[model samples]
Each structure stands twice: as C-alpha cells, then as structure tokens.
Target chain A: MALLELKSVSRHFGGVRAVDGLDLVIEPGQIFGLIGPNGSGKSTTVNLITGLFPLTSGSIVFQNEDLEKLPTHLRLQTGIARTFQNIRLFGQLTAWQNLWVAQNSPADWAKRGFFSRWLGGQSGVREEISQLLEFSGLAHRQDELAANLAFGEQRRLELARALATRPKLILLDEPAAGMNTEEIGQLRERILKIRAQGTTVLLVEHVMELVMGVTDRIAVLNFGQKIAEGTPVEVQADAAVRKAYLGGGE
Target chain B: MDFYFGLAQIIGVHTLLGLSAYIVLLTGQVSMAQAGFFAVGAYAAGMLTVLAGWAILPALAASSLLGAAVACAVGFPALRVKGLMLVIATLAFGEAVRLFFFNFDYQVARGGVKLGPLGGEGFRQIRYFPENGWTTMQVMLFIWIFVVLVMAILWWLDRSRYGAVLRAVGEDELAAQSVGINLTAVKVSAMTIGGAIAGLGGGIYAHYTTHIEHASFGILLATFALAYPILGGLGSVFGTVVAAIFVQGFLVEGLRFLGDWRNLLFGALIVLAMNLRPKGFLDAPTLRWIRRVFGGKRGAA
Candidate 1:
C-alpha cells in the first residue's frame, strides 16, 4: 500500500492555482523526487501534503488516514516531517539543542506522573540525540550555535533535526539549495541511508545531479500540474518533460 | 529592617508580574493582558474576602483560577493574530477589562439597608492579614515564599522539554509546528500560565496593600512588567528576575532621591541602559559567565 496518496488535490490562491489537479502516490520506503522550475507549485504540493496550507479541494490520505482536517503538528505526529526551503533552525539554540527540540515532541511520550515525566526520559533522549549528532557528523560541533555554523553544516543540522522526529515519510524541500557539490554528494548519501532505514523520502530539489543520482523514482511538475512521472531514466527521456523545460512545441 | 522587608515584598510581587510577562513572551506573544489577569485576581480575591467573607487562601486560589480562565478566554481569539496585531488585541483586552472594572457596580445589602457598592468605587479596605492577626513580616514572608516557588518552577522549566518547545516556538513558530509542537496549544498555555502567575501576584498585592483600585493595574504597569524580560535579557528566566529586581526593586526606589524629577531620571536611565547594553544586562554570554562562576555544568553552547 502507498504511504501517501493525494487524489486530485487543488489549491487556489485567489484566481491563481498554486497547485491544480495534483495526484500523487508515495509508497513506503520509496525515495521519490519532486522536480520543477520556479513557480511550478513544487513547494506548494509539499505544503499541501504536510498540511501547512488548507486544501482547496480533494483529499490527501496518509497511511490510509484522510489528512484534510489534520493540522500541521498533527500531521507531524502522524509521522510526516519536512525541512524548510529556507533553513529554519532555532538560530540561538545549539546544534544539539536544535535536534533536541525536534525530539522533545510531547506526543511521543507516555503519560506518567510528574517526576517521571520530568526526569525519566532524560537518559534515553540524551542517548538518541547523541547518536543523531554522530550520524549527522556534528558531534564535535554540537556545542556551537546553529546560526554560527557553516552553511553546509546548517543544512546537515536541519536534516538531522528532521530525522530526529523519527518520521515515516520526510519531505525535504530543496535540502541542497545552497550546498557545494561535495556537500550535495553527502546529502545524496544521507538520503539513501535514511531510505535504507525504512523511511520514505520525498525530495524537492532543483539540483538535478543529486535527484538523478539518489531518487529511485521522479515526478516532474509544470504550471502546478505533474508533467511527467517515472524512473529517472524514463523521466529524462520523456518528450513532455523536454517540451516543458525547453518551451518547445510538443 | 521593616523598610527593607517592604522593599523585598514589592520586589517579590513585581518579580511575579515580570515572570508572568516572560511566560507569554516565551511563545513570541507579547500580551499586555497580563495586567488584566492581575486585576481579575486582585478584584476576585478582594470581593470574595470582603463581601462573601472568604478566607485569604481560598480567595487567592479562586483568583488564580479566574485569572487563568480569563487568559484562556482572551488567548483563544487573541492569539489567532500574530506579532504586533496580537499585541494590540491584548492591549485592547486589557483596556476593556480595566474599563469594565471602572464602570462595574455590585451592591451588598441586608434585607432593607443599602451597603456600599463594590465595583465603580473600587474594592477597598481588604485587610486579609489584619483579621488573621498576622504581622507585616509574616505577610512579606508569605508573599516571598510563593515568589521563590514560582522562580524555582520557571528555572526548572528553562531546562525542561516544555521550556525547550516554548523557546523553539518563540524562535521559529513554523519550525516548531513542523516538529509536532502545537503552536496554538503552546501559545495559549503560555498565556494561561502567565495570567495565573500575575493573578497570584495580584492576590498578594491586594492583601499587602489592604486597598484595591482599577487604575492601579493599567497599561503602564503592564508595560513595566513586559520590560523586565527585555531589560533583563530575553535569553533566561533569571534575567527577568534580575531585571525586575534592578529596575523595579532598586533603580526605581533609588531614583526617589530626585523627588519630582524621579520619573525623568528613570526614563533617562532606561534609555541609557538600552543604548549601553542593547541585548540587556544578562544575555546568553553573561548567562554563560554566571553559570561558569557558580560551577554549573555548561550544556551545548
């Protein structure tokens, strides 16, 4: 069964259709890529799926549950998490603290007495955070404020923070937006590793190299609609995708 | 010693008010409605004790509960608006509450004789301690105990998951929301807690002063209370407490030597403080320094 299914979803902003008639299905453990030019509603589709914006029409079913009525936080609690297009770390908090905040979601804990609620979870949470820090290659710089980190490191920190939520499906919005080539390569490896651990990844990126190298399947969008959906090779060979990108007569 | 006790009592009450402001500010919501909550607490406690013949403890508890209820009621709609708009909404709510108190009238009477009205005249002669035969020191002690308890709770929250989520919401609401932290819940909780704290302070203030008035809990008091967290540094709870002590407890009292010019001096000092230390006296670095001085283990920067 698909991990996520969007049925004829449409989101209209005034007269403009930010995302129109979008149908998508992301199966469990699939590394899916969403690629499009600027203003193609790529980000809007992610927003719709994650419940950041209210759907204009149609339904989004995540793990067989209709997500239309769920708020963003509730969607997250249902094992969906996303990174921002622009990095949105808690700037003043340390790198470790950034991930810690994500891991500290109250819904994850069992209802307990006051003292146990306050003190009981520390050791386990601390161990998990340390492991995440190590996984993100940020153990040494865990003490540094997120705002003070290098751009690549900050992006990596955001990835780690998203992973800290233990999400079943992680939507990564342009995770490699400002990274250098080597950093992008590292991000590709990280995405594969995340997928290998049974987490589905929906990557939205303009970086074709990373997408082509990492994603198992790709969906292309143009003018708020899917132009092509296939394996990377098939998408690369699609005539419609070529026309959309080149602005040529189909 | 008595004079110092009085000073301590004022500092404690103001500190509670400051902490009240700090709580809502934690969720990046600047609510002036804390003063409204404070007023609710004071009036509730005053009217209950004076008219209903209630004890001090029960009056205080009722006042705190009423404060939380009023805050939750205001917060539900008011917090839907963000930043400056929310601030204006809360400011308006505070003014509305004050005006309601100003115009409100409640008459207490036996079968035929007319007793005094409670509202428009402002609830007065609320002598909680005198009836109990408690000394001024005892009253001061009582208020300070709650003050310390609140400070301790806030301090614990600073290191707890609840505080982590609050700080995250304050830093970036969208990010916090993405991580499954319910923005509205955190925001409303902050406001409710803040109101309850302010209400607690108000109950103490009513008993301590033996008098209550609508004008006493106005915008100026709210503004000063809000300034405590900012002037202390937005980074830590201790900063708010220290700022409250320095500004309301020490500086305001010390400036009295200027007599009629005291207000002018106080304003000038605030301006100078802002200029000299834009981040306030106890920013992250200062907090780190203090932690190191006290041999506290430092966490990740």
Candidate 2:
C-alpha cells in the first residue's frame, strides 16, 4: 500500500489554478522529488498536503486514512511534518530548545503525563534532545539562540527540528534554497540518512543536483499539473519535462 | 512604615498582573482583556466573602477559577482575530466587562446594613483583612506570599518545554503550527493561566484597598498590565516583576512629590526607556550579565 495518495487534488486561487488535478502516490521508504519552475504551484501543493491551505477539490489520504478534515497540527500528530520555504526557526529559542518544542511524536505524547510533558523539568528528556543535536552536528551550538547561528547551521537545525517530530513522511520545501555546494552535499546525505531510517521524504526543490542525487523517484510539475513521473533517469529523458524546463517548439 | 507596607502591597498585586500578561505575551497575542478577568475575580471574590459569608482563602480561589473560566471562554472567539484586530477585540471585551460592573447592582442586608456591589458606586467595604484583624504588615506579607508563589511557578514554567513552546508560537505562529503545536490550545491555555493570575491579583487588591469599582478596571489598568511585561522584556519572568516594581514603585510612587507633573514624566520616561532598550529593560543579554555579576550558575536556563 502507498504511504500517501493524492487523488485529483486541486487548489485554486480564484482565477489562478495554483494546483489543478494533481495525483500522486508515494510508497513508503521512497525519497520522492517534486520539481517545478517558479510559480508552478510546488509550494501550494506542499501547503495542501500539510493542510496549511484546504483543497478546492479531491482528497488526500495518508496511510489509507482520509485527511480532509485534519487540522495542520493534527496532521503532524498523524506523522506528517514539514519545513518552510523561507527559514522560520524560533529566533528567540535556543537550537536545543527549537527541537525540544517539536517533540510532538506519538511516543512522546503517549508516554509522558500532561504535567511531565509540558511543565515538569527537562531532565528526563535532555538525553534524547542531546542525541538529536549531535546528529545535526550542533552539539556545541545547542545552547546558542537560533537567530545567532550562521545561515547553513540554521538550515540544519530546521531539518533536525522536523525530524524531532518523528514523522513518517517529511515534506521539505526547498531545504537547500540558499546554500553553497558543500551545504547541498551535506543536505543530500542527510536526506538519504532520513530515508535510511524508513521515513519517506518529499523533496520539493529547484536545485537539480541534490534531487537527482538523492530521490529514488521524480515527478515534474508545470502549471499546476504533473508533467512527468518516473525514475530520475526516465524523468530527465522525458520531452514534456524538457519543454517545461527549457521551453521550445511544441 | 505603614506607607511602605501599603506600597509593598500595591507592588505585589501589580507584579501578579504583569506576570499574567507576560504568559499571554509569550504566545504572541497582545491581550488587553486582562483587566476584564481581574474585574471578574474582584467581584466574584467580594460577593463570596461579603454576601455568601465564605472564607477569604476559598473566596479568592473561587475568584481565580471564575477568572480562568471567563478568559477561556473569551479566548476561543477573541483569539480568532490576529494582530490589530485581536487588539481591538480584546480592548472591547475589557470595556464590556467594565460596563457590566458599571450597570451591575447586587445588595444584601447584613446586620441591617446593605452590602454588595452597587453598580457605578462600585463594591465597597471588602474588608476581609481588616475584619479578620490582620495588620497592615501581615497583609503585605500575605500578598507577597502569593506574589512569590506565582513568580516561582512562572519561573519554573519558563524553564520547561511548555515555556519554549509558548515562545515558539510568539516567534512564528505558522512555523509553530506546522511543527505540530496546536495554535488554539497553546494560545487559549496561556490566556486562561493569565486570567487566573490577574483574577488572583484583583481579589487581593479588593481586600487591600477595601474598595473596587468599574472605573478601576478600565483601559489604563489593562494598558499597565501589558506595559510591565513589555518594559521588563520577555527574557524571563523576573523581567516582569522588575518592570512592575519600576512602574508601580519608582515611576508612580517614587515621583509622587512631583505632584501632577509626574504623570507627564511617567509617560516620557516609559517612552524613553523603550527607546533606550528596544528589546526590553531586561533583555537576554542584560539578564545574562546580571547572572554573571551575581555569581549565579552560568548558562542556567
């Protein structure tokens, strides 16, 4: 069974059909890539999946359960988490605190009492957060406020924060937007590592280097519709994708 | 000595009020409805003690519960609006609470003398402390006990995961929500806790002053409730306490010899303070410095 299924999902902004008749099936453990040019409804599709904006038509199902009425936060509780296109870290909170607040996984919610989860001392949970900080190469910077971190470090922290939720499917909207080659390479390894842990990734990106290197399957979108869907090699060979990306005769 | 005790009582109550706003402000909502919750607590506790003949402690507890209930109820609808609209919504709710007290009239004959809230005249003779034979110093200490309790709780909360969650929401609502923080639950819970604190403070204020009227819980009180937290900085709960002392003690009481002219300076001083310290009077950096100088535990959250 597919981990996520989008059937004819459409989100229209009045006269503009931001995402029209989009259908996608993401199998579990696959690193899926959603590539599109600017204004091609890539972010809108992500927003729809995360319930930031409701769909104008059709349905989205996760683990075979309909997600029509689920709220944004509840969607995360159901094991779907995402990062922002532009960095939106809690500027006032420390890097450690940022991931601390995102520990909304089912296990975290069920095991701890209400008081212990929220109001009690952080002693019990410090070990877990420390491990996450170490994974993101931020052990030394754990106490530093997120705003003071360098740009690349902030991006890594955001990814680690999303992972803290222990999501089954992570939607990363341009995680490598403003990055040097070294940073992108690091991010690619991180994406592969996330997939190795059995969590699926939906990478919506403009940077072809990371997507082609990491994604197991690729889908190209143009004008709010899927133009091509296949393996990386197959997608690169598609004529429709070529026209969408490089614009030519027919 | 009595004058100092009375001033101490005022500072204590104002600290509770400021801390209430501090929690709500952490969630990034600028609520002007705190005075409404305070007024509800004041009236509820006064009626319980004066008319129902309840003990002061139980009456104050009831007052806190009522305040939290009203705030939780109002939070659902009022919190739907954001930014300036939310401000207007809360400001209007505060005024509505004041008007309710203004037109509210409930009196009962006790020992052949009418007692209770009498509309615009306000609820007078809330003399629980005096009737119980508690001295001014005792009452001051009593108020400070609650103040210290609230401060300790908030201080602990600031160190907890919930505190980080509140700050997360304030920093970015969208990101916070996307990260699985329920915008409604987090926001409403903050408001409810804030209401309880304000309500407890108001109950204490009614007893200390021996009087409370609709005019007391007006826009000015609400503004002051918000101002203390902002001036204190959102760095920690201590900021709110210090801000309350600075405003209620130094600005309002310390300059009393300046007569009516002090009011002008009060406004100027607050503005100047804000200009000099845009983040707050006790921002994170300043707080860190204080801890360093005082030889406190370095890097303690």
Most accurate candidate by TM-score: 2
Q: Tens digits of per-residue lDDT for model 1 on B48-159?
A: 8877888888988899888988898889999999989988999999999899888877767645643322566677677768878988788889998988899888877767
Per-candidate interface DockQ score: 0.56, 0.84
Candidate 1's residue-wise lDDT over A54-108, tens digit each?
A: 9999999999999988999888888999998999999888887788778634445
Which 10 successive residues of model 1 chain B have the least lDDT summed?
B110-119
- Cα deviation at B253, candidate 2, in Å, is 1.6
Docking quality of model 2: it rates as high
Candidates in order have lDDT scores of 0.85, 0.93
Mark the regions of model 2 whose C-alpha exceeds 4 Å error after superposition. B298-300
Q: Highest lDDT, which number?
A: 2
Clashing pairs in 2: none
